[model samples]
Target: MEKTYTVSVFTENSIGMMNRVTIVFTRRHLNIDSITASESEVPGVFRYTIVLRTTRQQVDKVVGQLEKVIDVIKAFVHEENDIVHQEVALYKIRTETLTNGDVEKVIREHHARVLTVDPQFMVIEKTGHVEETQLLFEKLRPYGVLEFARSGRVAVTKPMKELSTYLEEI
Candidate 1:
């Protein structure tokens, strides 16, 4: 059975490394649901978090292939429960919606905060899992959302040991 998997790839900062890492998945015909890259705890190292729906066998193979990339320092595949993750979503809604108390109530109910309120539009921000963000989006839709954007997942493993420790052991 296929399941969602989050692959974390640690690599030395280098040009074109992202392209090479993504090519591995492209070659396998796997579609990446989301991908985010940023500097890791280790100063010179970077981390790539990629989410995809694939079988365990296929994910394992993808991880193995990722490890073969020249700049990849380490790669690990994690089940949803194995890591804690979150995504940020920003919603742009017409400023007029704020005139009605219902919009404020809806925002409060969803636990979203108003980032900015201008004459033209109001910006609201929500940070949570995909479902949470989507729920907020749906609730605000009737109020007229001018724009919506949700970022890729950002995650950290559940293990107590820090990533730096793993890098040292390697």
Candidate 2:
């Protein structure tokens, strides 16, 4: 069965490393749902959080292939329960239709905020789980959305458990 897997990979910071990692998934015909790359807590290392849907076998194969890349230090696959994940989204909507109070309610309920406002449009920013972000999107759709963007899932395992340590033991 196919399931969503969030993979965290640590690699040397160098040119083409991201491309190499991305190409592995492309070659396998897997569509990455989302991806975020940033410096890790450790210096000289970069971390990538990638979300994709595939079978357990395919995920294992992909991670194995990723580990073989010269720049890749380690690649680990984490299911939903293994880590805490969050996604951020920015939405631009028509503010003329919704009252400030109504908008404030949505903002307070979802912990969103107005990032920008023009005479005609208001840009709202929100950070939350996938479903929570989607729910906000649905609520704002009625007011007409102008534009939006979402950061891919960023995940970290619970305290006392880290991907690098877990991989090193194996």
Candidate 3:
């Protein structure tokens, strides 16, 4: 059965490493739902969080392949329950609509906050799961959403041990 998987890849900073890491998925004809890369807790080491929907066997194979990449120090595949994750979404809506409707109530109900309010438009920020962000988008659409953007998933494993510990063991 197909299920969502988050692949956490730890690597050294290197040029073209991202392209090399992504090519493994491309060759397997797999589509990445979301990908985010940033520096890890350890200085100079980077982490790539990639989300994809595929079979467990396929994901395992991908992780094995990712580990073989030149710059990859370690690669791990995690089920949704194994990690805690969140995505941030930003919505830009017309300011005029706020005065005409109960958009404030809707925003409050969704637990989203206005980051900026200008004469023309207001930017609302929501941080949560993809579904939660999309829900907020839907609720604000009727009010006039000028723009919307959601970041890729950022996650950390549930285990008490940190990535540095794992790196040291290796």
Once superposed on the true structure, which residue ranges of model 3 sit more than 4 Å away at CA?
none
* Residue ranges of candidate 1 with Cα displaced over 4 Å: none
Pairs of residues at least 3 apart in sequence or in different chains that clash in candidate 1: none
Tens digit of lDDT per residue, candidate 1, span 33-150?
9999999988899999999999999999999999988989999999999999999999999998877799999889989999999999999999999999999999999999999999
After superposition, candidate 2 runs with Cα above 4 Å error: 98-100, 162-170
Cα TM-score per model: 0.97, 0.89, 0.98
* Superposition TM-score, candidate 2 onto the true structure: 0.89
lDDT of candidate model 2 versus the reference: 0.88
Candidate 3 lDDT by residue in tens digits, 23-84? 99999999999999999999999999999999999999999999998989999999999999
Which is better, 1 or 3, measured by TM-score?
3
Which of the two candidates, 1 or 2, achieves a greater lDDT against the reference? Answer: 1
Higher-TM-score candidate of 1 and 2? 1
Tell me the alpha-carbon RMSD of every candidate: 0.8, 2.3, 0.8
Name the better of 2 and 3 by lDDT: 3
